[model samples]
Target: MGIDYRGLRDPNAEYTMRDLAAESMGVTADRGGGRDVEITDVQTTMVDGNFPWTLVRVYTDAGIVGTGEAYWGAGAPELIERMAPFLVGENPLDIDRLTEHLIQRMSGEGSIGGVTVTAISGIEIALHDITGKILEVPAYQLLGGKYRDAVRVYCDCHTETEGGAGPPDGKPTGEDPPAADPIAVAEEAERVVSDLGYDALKFDLDVPSGHEKDRANRHLRNAEIAHKKAIVEAVTEAVGHRADVAFDCHWSFSGDSAKRLARALEQYDVWWLEDPVPPENHDVQREVTRSTSTPIAAGENVYRTHGQRRLLEEGAVDIVAPDLPKVGGMRETVKIADLADLYYVPVAMHNVSSPVATVASVHVGAAISNALAVEFHSYELDWWDDLVSETVIEEGYIEVPEQPGLGVTLDMDAVEAHMVEGEELFDEV
Candidate 1:
């Protein structure tokens, strides 16, 4: 005799007798809980944003679809296609198990850390969206609820005169040299802070200083250090206490030079110096962090929790900046934040994705207690928020959605208008 699922229903349980009857008949009831919904298909498309925004969609038998994005890269969409078969017929709610399965199954393809993991990260985020919608809760609630109603956002501003040149042979053109004007940088910073209302801002500090003799050696000359210092001073002085200012080096300097640059900005109330040295060597990164009073931030290049272990364990970074779409998805980023919190480090997400991943990152930032801010890299992209149905950021902050799943709907028209050339659109469900 088969056990009756109807008898298992409790008076206070969410599902009613009618819902249980539907489940016994293999029908999906209201709120998607009656019957098991399997993954029917996975699709991908690219949006030509600041980067090629790789968008993913996971379809279910119940007709519910979940959307996500991978960090912009060449191979992510293809890798998602390669992994789709394994997810077919599996329950989307089993997110952790499926993520681990993909990590192990694709271990040979460098899933331990790189494009493969980025692909899996995209799928994992889609799963969370599905699970949250089915469970009738917001995505941050699926990640263990939220700590705040809104997440602070930091804008990335570019100065008018910040430009450099390189030759076709991969050599520095030396002709253009770095011409980051302190005055122009300050003007832009003031406009973004005062006019745009961003309390946190970042400026690029890794441009040609017009004083480099050997660019490949990754050494900063005294003149180069002075030039960078001037820009930092001008921006910080321009913003004053109204906004906190950070600078990014893009990991383009050697250890000694990175330390020198960090020391030069110590006198100012700098937010942090980002990715001062290469990510491959944690010891050198740690040495640079310990060398100066200015806080050092990194980790956008790293992949999963294991990839971020040494950086937090050895105090390599004073602030952790994980790109959610790139760093093993949402849950993994929260785990990384929990690990950082144990060591008293804060999180600042490094983001350059579309409003899709930006909203996804906001949910993660809302869930984590130690979150500092989420980076907004597309302020210049006039149509960045048009890709979604709702306004993502307002007054330099993202309000956490109370609606189930990601809450924001993709504007198909905007997506079609900005779709990357030659890429196929998602099939109509």
Candidate 2:
């Protein structure tokens, strides 16, 4: 049987941009669909646990729906709900246009780099999912084909036993009680590497309880720095040549102190030193990066490509870790990676969401040549992958799906089972 390319155009007869722009743009009928898939409704729900997981779903007139998750936050669901009206009648396939429209529409709402962008990011991801499903392609293809089939994943792990002791909120903690000291941290690293098969891993280096100095001053006492170094040294030494280890300071130190800490940890040969200093001042970050042999990675808290562009253009950090769902979704993430590519920088996705966003990051990770690895923060949460129909990540890599959209349908049962108290699933729509 011969291939019927036109059969692949938007199945809905109610829409037809194909006649005008399809052939001229070299958009084969199979790949030119979804442009007419109009948004019918937008809805959000929250899941209670470590953080309030804000999930976004964009329903289209074509019966195709896309799901995305805003990075965990207080106003994410409300923010998405507020922006839903603007998106109601627009085309989910006009991803870039819709993204800009939302940005412009909410400009006065303080969307520069906060919950506003997170809301937009969730919506943007859903749009890509819709467009991909409509066109029968993967989300990465929408970003321009792919460079790799499997994206490496890094776990944001910890060694602390209890709350207020480990990586803190927004990061995962498990029932496997925390180990005692640096030795325990090493044991955790060994288990993660040997048992879990994750070649790259990260742990927090600046947990308050681990250090002795005052948190307000941004200055690190010698003992505090030494304690931080001990953690790094133990983890790296334990994993020795088996896995690459990274440490996160979470923007806890002053520039000078951060540099000193970075310089001190140089002997450990860490994979990357993350957010040693705060992210506000690029010059200071750049100075810290230049001062240390350990690679500096930052920008997870940054909102969109614009924020990352500033850091990349200034050579602020060695590696940029954009939280894909939080950093303006798939397209913006690809844009950020492309911009970083020009500067010969690599991208390490800062992920903390469930499988929906994990797979979304996999798509972006597949498309970018310099993508180092994507974070997997749900190792301890057994139900994390249950939220989706199938497990998207196994071992330490995501096998990019050829199936359309984000390639995973929401297991509503799993979602409902985890819903936050007093929250209804997509009830607003």
lDDT tens readout by residue for model 1, 16-104: 56466666777665322534687889999999998999999999988889999999999999999988877776678878978987887
List CA RMSD, all candidates: 6.4, 7.2
Q: TM-score of each candidate?
A: 0.91, 0.87
Clashes of each: 1, 1
Query: Which candidate tops lDDT?
Result: 1
Residue 400 displacement (Å), model 1: 0.5
lDDT of 2 by residue, 1-429 (tens): 333322223424444454435455665532225455568788988887566778889997788888888889888888887787777656677788778878887898888789899999999988888889888998999998999999999998975541243432324444322323677788999999999899999998766434443456678888778877887888999999989989888888889999999999888879999998887888898899999888999999777888888789988889999998788888888889989999999999998887888899999999889999999887888788888887687788889988998899888888899999888876422
In candidate 1 the C-alpha lDDT for residue 3 amounts to 30
Model 1, total clashes: 1
Which is the leading candidate under TM-score? 1
